[model samples]
Target chain A: MAIIKRYRALIILSIILLGLSLISPERGTQALSLTSASLIDMFSLLPPILVLVGLIDQWVDKQVLIKFMGDDSKFLGVIIALLLGGLAAGPLYIAFPIAITLLKKGANIRYVVFFLGVWTTAKLPIVLFEVAAFGWKYTLIHVSVGLIFFYLVGVFFEKRFDPNTLLKEDITSNE
Target chain B: MSQSIFLYGLIAILTGLSWFKDRQKTKKALMKAKNILVKLAPELLAILLFVGLSLSILTPETISSLIGERSGVIGVFIASFIGTFAMLPSFVVFPLADTLVSNGAGLVQVSAFIATLVSVGFASLPMERRIFGKEFTYMRNLSAMLMAFIFSFIIWVVLPWL
Candidate 1:
């Protein structure tokens, strides 16, 4: 019963997919295949990424996280956040878990938000592809503008919300 | 695929080294990984299903028509809306955007699409909220959508010169 409750959303979605398949077989099959492909892509990336998160969680010292990305780190914190975010691959959802770990380990909210912003805008591989597809000037403008905007947004939220409260919510929900 | 291989190799090396340093700690890390994976499985499945369903409904041709040259402001709105809901791979997005541009979609609209595509994730919101709670999830996504619109406007203003 507990498992069913936990998976209620997924169960409903599967049922809807099944019903749609009955009405429109071709489109439904296409959707199924695409879903499977995405699942494969996700599985390929998630294990190692999650394992890395786990290792970081267990092995890395909280003091080190605070030293690098805490409120007092200032400009150095921003730089580290950008590097971590920019080097990362995979979708933004993947970043959420990692971000949670960072927050749990004493990283400041501002830098955590900055890290997410960079992940959204300036990942290295995606930047290369964007430049190729949209010209260097366009890519540069988009990335620079995006980075500045989101950094400001991050700072804005950092001022408005208490990071400890957010972290507390994360803990209670997980338990 | 290559990315996966690289990640696997890196994780293998790191895990081995971790085990060498402390077996118990290494086991704890793997156990943590297992817990997260199990917790996230249902949410992941739901996200994948939604992505697949959305993609099926919004075929490339359909998207091209919706954001064509004359689409203007409406096109930007549509593009941003679709982008928020859809989660295409980056490789697919760049090429698709290029195709749309060559086929007469406005640069502003495509820019909006790309911006929101990378930033916002309506489909992944459940997972995000699960991890970060409701307020953070909503704020992050709303800010991203604002950024997407701002980007679209900038591109519109700057594109004629470029």
Candidate 2:
């Protein structure tokens, strides 16, 4: 019962898939195949990321992390955050665990937010692809505008929300 | 893919180093990884299902029709909305954007679609909320959506000049 309650959303989604399959077999099977493909992708990507996170959590000293990304780190913190985010691969979802782990290790909220912003918009491989698809001028404008906007958003969010309060649920809830 | 190979290589090196330093600590780290994987499995399944369903319903034809060149600001909004739900990889998304542009979608509309598609993840909100809490999740997504709109507007104005 507890497990079912915890997985209520997935259970509901599965039922919906089943109903859709009953209603239209072709589309339903297609959806199922897509889901399985994504699942395999997730499996391939997530384990290594999780392992890295776990290893970082265990090995990296809190003092060292704080010195680099802590509240007073400021400009240097932002630069480091951008580099980490820009170099990353995979989707926005992949960034969440890494972001939380950084927070857990005393990284400033603003830097963490900046990291997410960069991950979403300015990742290196994605930027290269964007340039190829949209032309250099368009990609330049998009990347610069997105980076500036997200930096401001990061600062704004840091001021608005207390890090301790924002991370409360994550700290307590094991997931 | 190359990314997977790179990731696996990195993990293997790190794991070996960690194990060499302290067997007990490495064991603990692996346990932590297992715990996260177990906890996240269900939410991940839900997210994948949502993506599959949305993609099936929002075919390329439907999207192109909704955001074709003459749709203007309304098209940008529609594109942004659709983007929030669709979560294809960046590699796939760029090509899809190119196809949409060739198929009559405006540059501004496609810009909105690509921007929001990469930045916002409504389908993965549950997982995000679980990690960062509700306020952070909502705020990040809303800000990303606003940024997408602004990006499209910039493109709409500037594309004419260039």
Candidate 3:
């Protein structure tokens, strides 16, 4: 868990770059050019946001978050997790820590999966970019269908995988 | 763009605060940044150059020929898998998908590929290992891939009617 947490940033950064590289060599170059600029751009948003997130991390503590996100009976936690996940911006790397934090706090596996699934699949900015690049029709088809698919996947994964345990294992191993 | 300026300013302030609070910690943080840059810059440049060469060398006809005609279910699957592996940004994929569609590519192929390109990927594995830890990242990606496949299938079936 310690190692996992420690190396998290490096891993996420590398994955993002890797994704860029696979886009044919020409697109890769453009990605590289954009990476630094994007980093600076992300930095602008991240620092302020991190300050807030960090504060939340510290203040909310793990127990409350867990309880808030863990309560499964009403599916309240699941809904909250999905909403947060759906609304989150940036890349998977940016989302991981927050997810981990929530996990430590006691968010359920279903919620985590929903959060993560949505976070990766749904982004208003990215959606807008897609729409602008493609067309409204394409964007509509993709997002509406994609959301339903993601939700179902989240539900399925939750049933199949023990997200809490997986996260717990990560944390314990890191420790 | 504006975000970059704000971030640089914030980082500057934070670094300054850390310096005043604890010089040693500040120095260590600076070293971490340097380390990341050192490891990152060369690889970034190399990848960019490689992409440039590949794009320049490969004819559009070749790309279209390879991806355009394969528009059936198999084609959609192939394109989505390839796109997932490729990871082209939405901006680039849009024009390319448009071109392919205009040329001869099926809507299913184009849509599926575009979705997969953004939503799922293997190229991101290394970074996923680093940031998300190996198991969690892989699981997440696997889930994404499965979902991408399903989404593409839905588009394949539905979009034509629309």
Regions of candidate 2 where Cα sits further than 4 Å from its true position: A1-5, A170-175
lDDT of model 2 at position A126: 87
Listed for every candidate in order, the interface RMSD values in angstroms are: 2.1, 1.8, 7.3
Expressed as tens digits, the lDDT of each residue in A1-175 for candidate 3 is 9656544545554565567668665556665665555444345444444443333443465666766777453467757866786655554544555666566667766676667666655665566666766678767877777667766766666676665445544321212
Best DockQ goes to which candidate?
A: 2
lDDT value, residue B14 of candidate 2 = 92
Q: Candidate 3 — which residues are off by over 4 angstroms?
A: A1-53, A73-75, A133-137, A163-165, A168-175, B2-63, B88-104, B130-135
Error of 1 at A29 (Å): 0.6
Of 2 and 3, the candidate ranking higher by DockQ? 2
A11: Cα error in model 2, Å: 3.0
Q: Return the TM-score for candidate 3, rounded to 2 decimals.
A: 0.65
Model 2 CAPRI rating: medium
Judge candidate 3 against the unseen true structure and give its global Cα lDDT, from 0 to 1: 0.58
State candidate 3's DockQ.
0.19
Q: What is the TM-score, restricted to chain A, for candidate 3? A: 0.63
Candidates' C-alpha lDDT:
0.87, 0.87, 0.58
- List DockQ, one per candidate, in order: 0.64, 0.68, 0.19
